[model samples]
Target: MGKITEFSEFAEAVKIANELVAQSAVAISARKMGHRALTVHAKPSASFAPGPSQEKIAAALAPNASLLKEDPLPGPATPIHDAVLARPSRLATPAPKGSQAAKDGIYRGDKLANALYAMCQRGGFSGALIVDDNGLPLAVHQSPVPEEAIGAFAIVLGTALAKAGKLLGQHNAENISIDINYTEKIVLRRFMLGQSPGYLLVICPQEVDERGEVELSIEQIAQILKRA
Candidate 1:
């Protein structure tokens, strides 16, 4: 009797799936190419801040203020997503000159990553992109962003988001941005001077709302990266 019931359920699901696919095909053909058709709110939030409905849980991406460090035991994942400084077991190398690519008085790629880890810790952000002054990618991790997506974003995307904040104008340019999906995220941020004059690319899990975080974080990080 249980087997018979399971088969019945499977058949019903397949029937619905076929019908939906047929409907979707018709909708696609009628829709404009690259046209986003999602319904918009009557009045999108006037405030520059992301809508209140989309804020991440405060503690989710809270900053790591703990002074105590964790023991670096080898983990299954590679250096890609793991914190480079904190993990002792991995063969992490020192960041070289121009590797960080931040502007004067700003922070480095690692520092930016730490800041983001503090802000959007809810979970979806999985990686980041640390770039240099020239908008070159230095380090990247866990992000689904293709290498091809990097070029246009370097100056154009950075400048556009800067209108949302002051960070973009601080150093004349920023090299990083973030892309957030439902359960995954990537931070494309710039990191500035010290030993490295480039950015730090970070990839992280998507724990917060991607739209809000992506807009705010990119502008801030870009400016900070040039200064770093």
Candidate 2:
């Protein structure tokens, strides 16, 4: 579903957030009211907590938020848990020099090798490479499938990431999530370049099992790229 632009008040946003944070037993009033923005926060911790930045945005809307007045977003010193979940994160390690690494070449065998290991545990599909946005290999763990097929899979995944960036309006696509199908697996992919450009994050699961696990793994790998 596309964005819902309803609900014109900060009170509405807060009301929805409170209900979600509580794990309310009923469909939220905001959902009933069809408040799109408010409904987004209907899940626990999904609401963007109000800190200075959020407070600033809220103040521009309603005078203030009750939750914000009492509590706030994680302070600067607060240790962030999942880096991916953070709205504004400056903690990622940089990938490399401005131009030391080729922007369009080199396979990321380091990361792919690990992903391959996990997929192999379940007799998963042939492994495909993860490549940067520019079609450079960031990593490659060979799938049990024919070696000749790997390049095409990588390229196809790479193309998907490039198109997705434009669709999402993000500088880089975020992560490779998993959505399983029994006989054949459905792989959700993402690409991000820390130093140069992002590469594909390929996922082949026995079946669609874990979304959170996939997200966490992608973030960990992305962090590695940031420092490389």
Candidate 3:
């Protein structure tokens, strides 16, 4: 009787445990189904509306169309006036023919000095001097040293060179170069004004074209002398 009682209690306990397990499984299944239903209903659905058409956009901006339009291109530039385009002269008017100024010795001397200055400027000379055959300075321009001394020496050198040329059976030396130092030189140019011989002594670098400058100086001097 005791063994049978023990067996019956064990069977009763197992049946209660089985029923509790089944109830727990059914509760878990119901919770999972509730979670899935809540998830499906909680999410928001995405929806899109159509954008405005081109015609609507144009109508909206019609009020500002004038501001948005580009400015018209500038018209062709006006032609410059002849008087406006003309450059002003800087030179003084010359004295009229046979005028008192033209006849004045002082005026002629000034003109001769101007001619010498122009020659020096054009040939890049350190100085220029015009001397008569008697070794007298007629005009001087931008002289670095004493013009009178240079004039005297130039005449002596020109005479010596002319003598040397005649000895060699050559014409009178028209152009004579004397090297003063390594970088500087003196060019003595012989030219004729009327029947008298004239001298031009120029101090410049050794590399300058002495002959060319001399010829140009001769032409300028001739013009001034003729005018006088």
* Best candidate according to lDDT: 3
lDDT of 1 at 105: 24
For model 2, what is the alpha-carbon lDDT of residue 144?
A: 25
Give the poorly placed runs of model 2, Cα more than 4 Å off: 1-108, 115-128, 144-148, 161-182, 186-188, 195-197, 201-206
1-228, model 2: which lDDT tens digit per residue? 334545456668878878876887456464444421210111112111112233333343243534334433234433222221333321222335554333533223434445533433333333334545433444444322222233334444555656777887764664443332233333545644645545444434344343454555566667656656
Model 1 collision count: 55
Ranking by TM-score: 3, 2, 1
User: How accurate locally, in lDDT, is each candidate?
Assistant: 0.40, 0.41, 0.57
Candidate 1 vs candidate 2: the TM-score winner is 2
Rank candidates by lDDT, best first: 3, 2, 1
State how far residue 122 of model 1 sits from its true place (Å). 3.7
- lDDT of candidate 3 vs native? 0.57
Model 1 Cα lDDT, one tens digit per residue, 1-228: 576647978889888878997777434556455433332111111111111111121211124312112212123334334333332321223444564433332235444544555333432444444444444443333223332233223433444445545744555453343433343333444434556444444444434445555556556666655564
TM-score of each: 0.29, 0.37, 0.52
TM-score of predicted structure 2: 0.37
Clashing pairs in 3: none
Clash tally, candidates in order: 55, 16, 0
Instruction: Give the Cα error of residue 69 in candidate 3, in Å.
Output: 91
